[model samples]
Target: MNEESRTNIGTPVPDASNPEEVREQVERTRDELGRTVEALAAKADVKAQAKEKTAAAKEQASEKAALMADQLRAKAEQATQLVKDKTPDPVLEKTAQAAAHVRETATRAGQYAAERAPDPLLENAGKAASFARANRNQLLAGGALLAAFLLVRRGRGRR
Candidate 1:
């Protein structure tokens, strides 16, 4: 409200006395209004805003992951200490023996299975190739449809 502070730094308010001045002012205002609308629209874009939020979330998650690991390590240490303090010597010995037995059994079984199933990956791949060859027409049709759908969506996105 102070006269000393008042200055015409922006577009002036239209005075209706001059018709040409009013029209010029109206046009200027429309241009400004259009720009304002465009800026607002850009700000309100949900996908862009979501992407910004997702990036912020990913950054925070990466920062928190280190903290989470430290917390888990602390918890694991506490659990181990508690177990050592509470468990009986006899029970611990039995548990260790049981774990050893399980490991031995698993190792022997794995060796037996591996002996029986040599070249598993190659065999499975051969079977897969045979199945695909048998169903080539259906697979090709499905692939073409998927490709067309993706291409159409990509075209629409570019527009």
Candidate 2:
């Protein structure tokens, strides 16, 4: 084709002089149109847009939950410190002694149970104890928080 007749890059103009060239151009235009239609249809799809929004919301919610968990852990530590500060040293020592006695009793009971309990029960108890040991810090913090809350409530009632 002459440079004068050509337009938009090397794309040929549809003319009667070359039927084959016109056919090729028509096919190319149809392919381009089909792709454009598909892009528009995808943009118009409600379900796909909804799914994208839901994924973004879930990611945001997960981030917020992680942040909240960290804050809660910090607060638990502070509550535990406050409890330790308020308690008398003699009371603390007595509490520790009582805890040791309880531990000794538990050890003897566990030994007796090991001798007579079924294998499945012992296995489950072992798993529970393992989990408790692994999460001892968290457990202690929780217990301290509960104790602080109860003390606050009792003090308020006395007033």
Candidate 3:
């Protein structure tokens, strides 16, 4: 490697015969160098790259968790259906009777309480019961979700 050749490795060598051509070449070289520096700086930014990777990983994990929850819900529904299908007709009838009895007992208890409780407390309890009746489906779904979460946590603890 001769000294001149080594020194001129990257430096632009424009035509000295035309000042205009030399100026254009220098401008082109400067633009190219600016682009190169920007690319190198992006590559060297470790924090930015790590942040990008973390965001992608978090998105992927969220998607996977959602998919898993959907699968678990489907499986639980299937299990419930299977159990219902396998239960005897007489057992189902007996269960329904027991549920009816429980409802009757609860109603009797509520009436007794309403007779003895303060008017304001009774009014509040009536409102709460009305709300419970109005939002039964939502309340049941929330309770089921809480139960499922507890069951899963318990199962993990056992493991």
RMSD of each: 23.1, 6.7, 9.1
Candidate 2, TM-score vs. the true structure?
A: 0.63
| Higher-scoring candidate on TM-score, 2 or 3 | 2
lDDT of 3 by residue, 51-132 (tens): 9999999999999999999998788667666555665565556555655686699799999998899999999998999998
Q: How accurate is candidate 3 locally (lDDT)?
A: 0.77
Error of 2 at 6 (Å): 22
Please list the residue runs of candidate 2 whose C-alpha ends up more than 4 Å from where it truly belongs after superposition: 1-39, 138-159
Candidate 3 clash pair list: none
Q: Which is better, 1 or 2, measured by TM-score?
A: 2
lDDT (CA) per prediction: 0.70, 0.80, 0.77
Per-prediction TM-score: 0.40, 0.63, 0.58
lDDT of candidate 2 over 67-139, digit per residue (tens): 9999998997787787778776655565566557867998999999999999999999999989988887666
Model 3 lDDT at residue 140: 45
Task: State the TM-score for model 1.
Answer: 0.40
What is the alpha-carbon lDDT for the whole of candidate 1? Answer: 0.70
Alpha-carbon deviation at 136 in model 2, angstroms:
2.4
Return the top candidate by TM-score: 2
